[model samples]
Target: MEKFSTHTGIAVPLRQSNVDTDQIIPAVYLKRITKTGFDDALFASWRKNDDFVLNREPYRQGSVLVAGPDFGTGSSREHAVWALRDYGFKVVISSRFADIFRGNSGKQGLLAAQVEQSDVELIWKRIEEEPGTEVTVDLESRTVTVGSLTVPFQIDDYTRWRLTEGLDDIGLTLQHEEDISAYEARRPAWLPRTLPART
Candidate 1:
């Protein structure tokens, strides 16, 4: 996971609400084994329309996504988060997000910003009105700023700390490596210990 303190980039407004996991990456693309190359599969169906927000110029290169209410609402596929990251969006702002999707986003270093409905509309307007304008998402200050409007958002303290530190579950565990190694050294030899790697 990457540290997310502050990010400033073009904002793409996705007006659709209730975007599901299947629509996000589509189940067809899930068969691939790799975790980081799902960009082409993101919004795969919608992109075919040629006029989808993500398929348009400027918005196609946006790194920040401003979406409508109930933005991420559907299944618990972590691939949805992966697709968004691979598609180059560092932050996704919306009025509401499904709990599962929000959790996945946090673990994968994608900021799922929850704001009021009015704020979501305001941000969407700004992005759509100024196609290539930049929006700044500051995790430290818990705010999203674009043009003359700035809105504050809420995220749990622990998740915020983890994101700012760039520590995923594995990264957090590795921080206790010294203690883990010490405990392993003290283990008795007759406890049916596991074998070492064959390498």
Candidate 2:
């Protein structure tokens, strides 16, 4: 996980709606448990066609993705967020997102931004009309600024803190390691252990 306070980069406009987890990383790529190698399999089916927005030169190097409504609306696969992060995308802006997908993304340190449908449409048009159009997403201010419009988005306190500080679930737990160790050391002998049970 990486801190994401502010990001200004080229926005790859994905004009499609109802983009599900299957389309993101595909079921075939789900066999592996590791996170690093999934980038190659991201949008695998679409990649083969060579007509996908991600395959285009200018958008291929983008750090932010602007998509239509109903983004990430399928199975509750955390891998979708991993694949996006593995592909170097930090933020995904859409008019709407599936609840589970949004939660998964936050845990993985990917920002899921919700904007008005009209605002998203405006951004889509702008980016399509001019490739390499950059947008700025400022989490600190909860503002997403395109060329002339700035839209506000809401994020929960815990999720916002996790993303801003790059803290995953493990990272959050590790912060209390000292207390946990002390408690473990103070446990009585009656407490269960990994040793064999008495006959």
User: Would you give me the overall lDDT of model 1?
Assistant: 0.89
Alpha carbon lDDT at 151, candidate 2: 80
Clashing pairs in 1: none
Q: Per-residue alpha-carbon lDDT of model 2 for 1-199, expressed as tens digits?
A: 7788999988998888999989997888889978667788888899898888888989999989998889999998888998998898989998899999999989888899888889888888888888998889999998888888788877777889888988769867999999999999899989877679665
- For model 1, residues 1-199, the per-residue Cα lDDT tens digits are 7899999999998888888888998889988888889999888999999889888899999998888777778878888999999989999988888899999999999999888989888887787787998999999999999988899998999899999999869867899999999999999987763576444
TM-score of 1: 0.85
After TM-score superposition, what is the CA distance of residue 46 in candidate 2 from its true location, in Å? 0.8
* Residue 3 alpha-carbon offset, candidate 1, angstroms: 0.9
Model 1: runs farther than 4 Å from truth?
Answer: 171-199
Please, what is the whole-model Cα lDDT of each candidate in the order they appear? 0.89, 0.88
